[model samples]
Target: MERTYSVLVFGNEENDIMLILKFTDQKFQSLSDFLNSEVHNFYTHIQKELEAVVTGQKEESDFGGNMLNIDIGKEETEVYYQMDDESLGEPCFISTDELYKLVLEWKEMEEKMRRGEDIFPVILED
Candidate 1:
């Protein structure tokens, strides 16, 4: 019924929900730009991504797991994202750059996990 969008900015500190926006725009750059623009289409943006994932030709996504899995092709621009199931909150968009970095980091972490190195939290330490 309404528009909504979510921005998932990786935080180094705790106690931050990042910024989630919901609105419509004639000119919106990156998702960051859309969120930074104002506090507005929290649903519209999310539905957009959902449509891509849910209604896409692939019909399957590697969102979360033990390994790093993300691929955004030309026909289908995919990226990692998440939303709180309990919170019923807005969906967060994982920027392409961040997604790539996360994938690489997660791959390394997964390898370490397989080797039985340091496997505890799935946090990408900067």
Candidate 2:
């Protein structure tokens, strides 16, 4: 069965942003486990990257423009950055609280899926 989870992306020019990050069941479990341990490290990395940008210690060329892209799959996990527009500034650093909330949301979704609920479904209208 197709398995996927999505998170609402912030720090963009347009609102109501959603990023549907696809992952296999195994990979999703792995990510859930990793988040339990390394979420802080993830947050730290983003903070350092933003700090470097502000201080000019690192050139913008060193990293992708702004939006942080995280792709996870059965084979591997990848994280990178991209700019939505020239008007959009640097990616917003996710605060610890926000990260925690995201983790909670992910876990809740997982649980709901495990219960065989339709987490996302297409609605047909006649």
Candidate 3:
């Protein structure tokens, strides 16, 4: 199946950070609530988890309120996403290199947003 991933970043009056993930037909998003100062911690934890996954130390990892499930393998990482009950798409297998690049892109986007810079969202397709 044709697979695509998109990240949508929004900067509003409240400095909202929304990272939208589109996997095939399903749509999942990571909404950051910066009020409690948890965004940094969230990204840090996710990066560590992703590293563990890539190093064969973790088999699976969950992100964003169980919206995504990542299964790590020797060559590719399978990602399953669900948005509510209406949208549940097929799993997408992303290569290790692609996954790592995507994570870095996300982190960079988040950093830009935090620095009060006007930014645009990035989309990934494979």
Across 10-59, the per-residue lDDT of candidate 2 in tens digits comes to 66544433323333434233333334333323545544443454445644
Best by TM-score: 3
Q: Write one digit per residue (lDDT tens) for candidate 1, span 18-120.
A: 4333334322123323233221223333333334554454443433322112344323333322332423223334544343343333334434544545434
Task: Give the alpha-carbon lDDT of every model.
Answer: 0.35, 0.39, 0.50
What is the full ranking by TM-score, best candidate first? 3, 1, 2
- Looking at candidate 2, what is the lDDT of residue 80? 34
The 10-residue segment with the lowest total lDDT in model 2: 59-68
- Tell me, by lDDT, which candidate is best: 3
Off by over 4 Å in 3: 1-13, 21-42, 53-65, 82-86, 121-126
Q: Give candidate 1's whole-model lDDT.
A: 0.35
> Which lDDT tens digits does candidate 3 get at residues 1-126?
123323344665565554443434332222212101222446676566667767778766645423554555546765555444424445566665566556665566666656756544444555
Off by over 4 Å in 2: 1-92, 121-126
Q: Which residue pairs collide in model 3, if any?
A: none
Full-model lDDT, candidate 3: 0.50
Q: How far off is model 3, as Cα RMSD?
A: 6.4
